[model samples]
Every structure is written in C-alpha cells, then in structure tokens.
Target: MYDLIIIGAGASGLISAIVASSSGEKVLLIEKMSQAGRKLRITGKGRCNLTNTLPLKEFLKHCGSEPRFLYPAFNLFFSKELINFFEQLGLKTVEERGGRIFPQSGKAQDVFLALINEIEDSSCQVLKDTQVTSLMIENNRIVGVKAQSRTKGNKEYLAKKVILAAGGESYPLTGSQGDGIRLAKAAGHNIIPTLPSLVGLKLKDYNQERIHPSIVGFGVRNVKATISLESGKKIAEEFGELTFRENGVEGPIIITLSRQIARLLSQGERLFLNIDFKTALSEQELDEKLLSELNIRGKEDLRSVLRAFLPHELIYLAIYQTALDPRKKASFVTSQERKEILAFLKHCQFEIIGDFGYEQAIVTQGGVDLKEINPKTLESKLIKGLHFAGEVMDLDADTGGFNLQIAFSTGYLAAQNAEKED
Candidate 1:
C-alpha cells in the first residue's frame, strides 16, 4: 500500500506529492486528464505566476475572508519557501509588478515540467487518465479511492492516506469540473455555495460595436472603483486598472470586485459601479483644472477639449449620454453642464447585471468551509486520513499571485502534517 495518495495533479497536488515523497513517503498522484497541470499551463497567459514576494502578513491581507485561518499554512510555507523550492528544482524566478513572481524563462510549461520532474525524481507514481469515482472509507476514516483508469476500464487503488487537491469549478476545459466538490460532499464535508471570483461583469447594454470601440481593450489606470449595492451601501472598493469589455468591465480592479458583486446579486441586489477615473485628483483639483482648460481654449468645443483628460471614446460617450452637442464651444457650456461632466468623469457608473460565470473566473469564491478542516493539518475534522488542499478549500485571495500562494502553502502544510502523522 502507498503511504499517501494525492488526487488531482494541478499545482497543489504536484507540490503536495513532491513534499510528501521527499519526506520518504511512497506517494501516488492521480489525474483525470491525460497530462498534468493543464490549468497551470494556461495561468498568467502561459507565464505561470508562481507566487508573490510580499510579506506573509501582507499576503494574508489579500484574502478577503478568514485571514487568521491561513496563519498556520503561511507560517509554515511562505512565499520565500516557495521561491526556494522552485529554485532547488532549477526553475529560477523573477519578481514583477505587485510582487508577482514568474519564471525567468517566462514559460508556464517550464514551471509545470519542473514540478513534474521533481515529482518523478522523488520516485512518486503518477497515474494519468484516471478518474476517481468514489472514496473508500472505513470507520470514519478514508481507506483509499476507487477510480477508473482510461487504459484499464474499471480498476481501483487503495492507499493509507488521500489528499484531495482537485481544483474548484472554474475553467472546466482545464479539468477543474467540480469533481472534488462532489467527492467532498460524498465524504460528508460541508460544501459552501460556490461562485465565480475574479471574473468579468456582464452589463445590460448590448450596443456591442459602440461599447467595444469606446471601452473594450482600453484600461483606466490608477482608478478607484466602488460597487454601490441596491441598499445604497458600498460593498467593495479597489484601485487599479479597469478594462472595459465588450459587455462590461474587467481587469484586476473589476475582477476583485466581481466576487462581492456576485454574492450581492445572489441576494437579489442590483449593482452600480462608480469609477473615479482621476482618483488622485480631488473634486476641487479637477474643477480648477477644468476651469483652466476651458478658459485657455474658450473657442474650442467642450467635447473636443475634454479629450485631453479622458479617452476620446469616453468623451464621446459622455457627450451622447448628457445629450450635449460635441461641437458646442467651451464658453457656451453652463456650470450645470460642467458639473455633469465632472460627475461623469468622477462617478462613471455601470449597471452590473451579473458575472461572466466560471468560465472566465480566476478562482472560485466559496468551497469546502474552513471550519470543518483543521487549519494546522488541513485534514477534515469529521474524517481521518482524508485531507484537502488548494482551491478545494474555502480559502481564496485576490489577484497578484496570492491565490497560487495559498494553494502552495496549504498543500505543503497538508502533506507535511500527513507525513508526520504517518
């Protein structure tokens, strides 16, 4: 019998298998796909953001909820440890903006291949094209897993311990098809309501060509975006790039707000996002600047003059929405019109009808509740020898490589504790 069996060969599974095997445990890693790290290969547009170089406390802050829940994992295997681990595997890393660490080679495949090579060198057995059908439990403890191999139709393997690192239900094409959630539910673990996090927002307006030309691919930098809930309470506030999509808003800023927006939407609340395009400029500063520009170019059209401060598409959109003639001179613009212009620039609003769904989400917001798992060991409180790691757990963070760090940290903690217990 193997010492440890890891289900799913994604980032977390790969790390856990490597750690467990290096500790002298006979580890068996199973994957449903023909190859491993399908999702990892596509992350960061193939660059594979491994982890962030931020401090442990700062990294935990990116996690929206249950910051304390990650204390044990972060303390055990932080980002520095991860960098060291990759370096030991011959994969050099580089830090980019926001402390995001990517491979020096700039290839996600290199990262995956490096991890796979380490797993192989450690004498770990990797079984591909194998789909786990069910968990084999005895006396409230997991005994082994029953899976069907593509080569040998209905066969099963038994092990002493099992780690469920199967990813959350996002990017199904990458093999994250909610199978782990199904397994957790079968094993009597509480599965939290899952929603798409770090996904784009879908708007009501279908004026595709107009929206695409004006907003799509255009990123508003250093902007503060606030999601105004139906109750008039603002839920989330973020400052970053706001990428306008053909349907709605996207990019790091919008994706960060998408989780809260999606949760509010589930409660029958409609969303309205306000974008402060000039977040660095106060109202007084913006007003004064506008007055100066208007005074200097009194004969110039207000719409044409505002293009210096905003994108041409945005200026045109503002003019169209305010029903102002683009050809009107700045001198003819009334104070009320200027106020409207300021409001549009400061509070660029968009009605968020819904999220873009899991297909585009970077992570699943909710998963197996954390309370049911021992944070130190990452093992289920209700089950023995059955552990969880990575996105399958409730822990998730905002963008900038924090989520991947969570996966690596928790996976290491789980494998380490499991090996110790063995």
Candidate 2:
C-alpha cells in the first residue's frame, strides 16, 4: 500500500508526489495523458511563465474565489520558494516585465523535464494514461482510488491519503476536462458551477471586414478598457495591451478581466467593452494634438495624415466609423469630421455578445467549493485523508504566473500535511 496516491500528473500532482516521496513515503502519481504535464509543456505560449515576483499582499489581489484560503499555501511556499525549487532542480529562471518569471532557457519542456526528472530520481511510481474514475472510500474516509487504463485495465491502489489534483475543466485536449471535480462531487463535495475564464470574448455586430483575419492579431498597446452594463453601470476595468481576435478582443487585459465578464454574461446580462485609446491625454489635449497634425500636414491625404495618429489598420476602422473620406485633404477636413474621428479614437465601443468556451479558455473559474476544504491544511473537511490542490479547488487567478504558483504551493502543502500520522 502506498502512503499517498496523487491523482493527475499535472503541476500540482507531480509536486505532491515529489514532495511526499522525497520524505520516504511511498507515492503513486497518475496521469491520463500519454506524457505528463502536456498542458504545462505549452503554457506561456510555449515559454512557461513559472511564477510572479509580486509581494504576498499584491499577489493575492490578483487571485479570485476566496483568495484568503490560499494564505496557508502561499505562506508555506510562494514565488521565491518556487523559484528556488526549480533552480535547485537545475532549471535556471529569469524575471521578465510585470514580474513574470520564465525559464532562462525559454523552453517549457525544460520546466517539465525538471519536474519529471525529479520524480524519476525519487521513490514515487508514475502511471501514464491511467484515468482515476472514483475515490474508494469507507465511512467517508479515503481508503484508495479506482482507476482504469487502456493497457492495464481497471485497477485499484490502496492508500490512506489521496491528493486530488485533477485540474480544472479548461484545455480538455490537455486531459483536465473536470475529472477532478467529478471525483470530488461523487465524494460528496459541493461544487461551484464551472465557467470559462481567461478566454477571448466575442463581440456583438462583429464586422468581418473590420476585424478580418488580416488584422486578427493586431494589438493595441497602453490602453484602458472598461466593461459596463447597458444601463451605463461600470462592471470592471483593466489597463494594458489587448489584441484583436477574429471574433473580438483578447490578450493580457481581456484575459485578466475575463472571469467577471464571463460570469456576468452567463447571467444573461448585457455588456459592452469600451476602449479608451488616448487615456494618457485628456480630450482637450488630444484635440490640440489632432489639430496640429492636421494643420501641419494639410497637403497630405486625410488617410495619410491619420497614419501619424493610429496604425494603418486602425485608420481603416476610424474611417469606416467616422464616415470620413480618406481621399480628402487634411486641410479640407471639417471641424465636425475631426470631432467624429477624435470620438471614435477615444471611446471605441463594442457590444460583448459572449465569451469563448472552455476549449479556448486558459483556466476554469469554479470547482470544488472552498468552504468544504480546510484552508490551513488543504484537506477536505468532510472527508479525512482526502486533500485537494490546484485548479480542482475554487481557486483561480489572473495571468502572470499566479495560477501556476497556486498549483505548486497548494500541492506541496497538501502532500506535506497528508504524510503526517493521524
């Protein structure tokens, strides 16, 4: 009988097995995928942003769904400890803009290699392509887990402790697919309904010609985006860069605010996205700048003159929205035309029709409810010896390595506490 059986070989499960087995406990790590960490191998656009360097208070602000529940986990092991853990495994890291950390080698495979190598060196046994279907419980305490494998058929592993790190519902191809939540539900845990978070949001009245595939990847930098109700009530706001997708908008800001947007949209609320391009400059300042550009380049075509203010692609959108003739000389442009152009540039609005589904989402917003689990120990309060970790819990965070840190810290804490005698 193993001392601990860890479900899923993703970020949290791997760390759980490593930490548990390193302390001379017999550990079994299971993965439904052909190889472990398939999702991890592709995170950060294939570069793998490991964790953030923000201080604890600032970092927790980025997390959602009971951020205080993670106090114990982060206190145990945070970004600094996580970095040191990887470096000790011979994986050097570097911090980039916005305090995001990545492997110095710029290879996510290297990060996976570091974890898998540590597992191979430890006493833990790993099983790939094995799906744990249920927790084997007796009198509401975890006794073991029942799993099925294509080659090995149905199997049962006996262990007093089981760490469920089966991940969230996002990226089904990576083998998450809400399996962990299913197991938790079957074990009598109340699950918060799951929603796609950090995904692209679709826009109403989408113009194929304007946001065509040609400009789908076009990004706007240093802008402020606001989401508001049809009643003009502000919902959420973000500042950074956002990229135009074929359906609507995406990127750093969009993904960070996607959870709130997705939740509101799911409730059948009318939402709109407002982009303020000239946030750094007031309306009067922007108008003065536009006047100077038009007067100085009076001989230039209005289209050519607009190039000084916006990207060539955005100029087309500006012209389409303002109904201004591109061929007109800048000097001949009327005051009304200039005002329309300025308005479109300052407050470009789009109705948010819906958001992308789980397939395109970076994380799942809900999972096992936090109240049912012990915040300090990460064990299920309803079931002794059953611990929870990673995205399987109702914990999720914004972009910039916060989510991955949650996985590592919670996994380590769950395993470290699970190995103790009852």
Candidate 3:
C-alpha cells in the first residue's frame, strides 16, 4: 500500500507527488494518457504562463465561484514559493507584461519536463495509461482507487490517502473530460454544474451584416468594449484590441469578460457589446473633428472622406448601415448623415448570443463546490484522507497566470496535509 494515490498526472497531480515524495513517502501518480501534462504542454500557446506575479489580494480577485477558498493555500505556498520550486528544479523562468511568468526558453514542454523530472528524481511511481474508474471508499473514509489500464486490465490499489487532481471539463483531448466531477459526486460531494469560461462569444447571425469574409480577420486596437444587459444595465467593460471572428469576438479583453457574461448569456438574458472605436477622443471632440473634416474635404467623395477615420471594409458597412451613398460628395452630405456615422463609430454594437463552448473554452467555470472541502488542508470535510486541487475544485480564474498558480499551490498544500496525517 502506498501513502498517497494521486489521480491524473497533470499540473496538480505532479506537484502533489513531488511534494509528498520529497520526504520519501511512497507515492503513486496515475494518468490515463501515455504522456504526463498533455494540457500543460500546450498552455499559453506553448510558452506556458506559469504564474502571475500579482500581489496576493490582487491575484485572488481574478478567481471565480470563490476566490477566498484559495486564501489558505496561497498563504502557505504563494507565487514566490512556486517559482522557487521550479527554479530549484532547474527550470529558469522570466516575467513578461502584466507580471506573467514563463520559462526563459519559452517552451511549455520544458516546464512540463522539469516537473516530470522532479517527480522521477523523487522516486515517485508513475502509472501512465491507467484511467482511474472510481475512488475506493469505506465508511466515508478514503481507501484507495480502482483503475483500468490499457495494457494491464482491471486493478484495485489501496492507499492511506487519495488526492484527486483530475482537472475540469475543458480540453477533452487533453484528458480533462469532467471525470473529476463524477468521482466527486459519487463520493458525496456537491458539484456546481460546469460552464464554459474564457472563451469567444458567437453573435447572432440574423442580419449577417456584422461579419463577412473580408471582415472575419479584422482587428481594431485601443478600443473600449462595454457589455450591457437587454434591460440596459451595465455589466462589465474592457479596453484593448478586439478581434472580430466570422462567429463573434475574441482577444485578451473579450476572453476576460467571457467569464462574467457566460451565465447571463446562457440564461437567455439578451446581452450586447458596445465598442468605442475612438476611445482617445470624447464624442463631442470626435464629432467636431468629423464636421471640420467634412467642411474642409467636402469636395471629396463621402467614401474618400471616411478614409480619414476608418478602414475600407468598415466604411463599406458604414455606407450600407447609414444608407449613405459612397459616391455622394462630402459637401452634399446631410448633418443627419454625419450623426449616424458618428454614432456607428462611437457605439458599434453586437448581440452576444452564445459562446464557443468547452471545446474552445480556456477553462471550465465550475466543479466540486468549495464549501465541502477544508480550505487550509484541501481535505474533504465528508471523507477522511480525501483531497482536491486545481480546476477540479470549483476554482478558475481569468486568463493570466492565476489558474496555473492555483493548481500548483493547492497541490502542494494537499500533499503536505495528506502526508502530515501519517
């Protein structure tokens, strides 16, 4: 029998094994995939944003469901400890914009290898291609786990403790297929139904005017995006480059707000995105410049005058939407026509009908409810010697390095507390 049986060889499971086995505790890590860290290898487009360098309070705000649930874990093994752990393991790291940390070599595979190497060096046994079917429990206490191996058939292994770090429902190909939630439910843990977050929103295709082949890849810089309910209540707003897809919106800002609107949009509340193309100028200031330009350049075609403010494809829509003739000389343009153009630039809008779903979502927004787990130790309040970490524990955060750090910190704490019982 082993001292710890950690399920899933992703970020959390690997860290848990590394920490627990450091004292030479007998640890077994099980993974369904042949390779460890399948998902971790592809994070941050392979650069792997390992952790955010945000101060504790600021960093916690990026999380959802409950940010405070991670306070105890962070207090024990915050970002500094995490970075130091990797640095000691021989993976040199560097920090980028917004305090995001990554490997200096800029390869996620390198970071993944360093963790695997640490696990190997710790003498922890790793069982690859072994899928955990269920947690073995007796009298609401941890026993071990049953598994099905591709090469070795059915088997049951008993351990003094079990740490489930199987992750959430996002990136199914990476082995996060919601198995953790099912395992938690079977063990009597309440699960908050999962939803897609940090994903692109697909707008209604009714008018079909918002997107066309020419506009599909268009990107605007330094724009302010505002989300409002159909009832005209402001929800959230972000400012950055917004990229338009044939389906809808994406980019740093759009993905960041996706989490806030996912629930409301799914509930059938009509939500709209209002973009300000000229954030640098007040509406009055922009209008005055437009009027002055029209007065000075009125002899030119309206399409030509519009070139001073917009791209050709965007002006094409402006021409169609406002019923303004492209061939009309600026001098002949009506004041009402100018107002329409001004409104379109300052308040371009689209309806957010749906998201790209889990297939494209960066992370799942829900999992085992945090209330059932002990915050300090990450142990289950219902089951002795049972622990949780990472995306499987109803903890997710905005895109940055916050989520990865949560996984590392919780994993470290779970293993420490799990073995401390021994």
Model 3 worst lDDT run, 10 consecutive residues = 204-213
Query: Candidate 2 — worst ten consecutive residues by lDDT sum?
Result: 206-215
Note the residue pairs that clash in candidate 3. none
By TM-score, the candidates rank as 3, 2, 1
Please report how far candidate 3 places residue 194 from its true position, in Å: 0.8
| Reference-based TM-score of each model | 0.93, 0.95, 0.95
Model 3 gets an lDDT of: 0.89
Q: 339 in model 3: Cα distance from truth in Å? A: 1.9
Q: Pick the candidate with the highest lDDT.
A: 2
- TM-score result, candidate 3: 0.95
Full ranking by lDDT: 2, 3, 1
Per-residue lDDT of candidate 1, residues 217-273 (tens digit)? 777789999988767688889988877777777998888888666677767688888
RMSD per model, one decimal: 2.1, 1.9, 1.8
Q: Please provide, for model 2 over 1-422, each residue's C-alpha lDDT reduced to its tens digit, 9 standing for 90 to 100.
A: 98899999999998998899888998999998899998999999999999999999999998985889999999999999999999999999999999999999999999999999999999899999899999999998999999999999999999989999999999999999999999999999999989999998898866747544456788999999999999999999999899887888889899877877777888889898988888988999999999999999999999988898888878767776677899999999999989988887788888998887899999999899999999888999899899999999998998899999999999999998987753
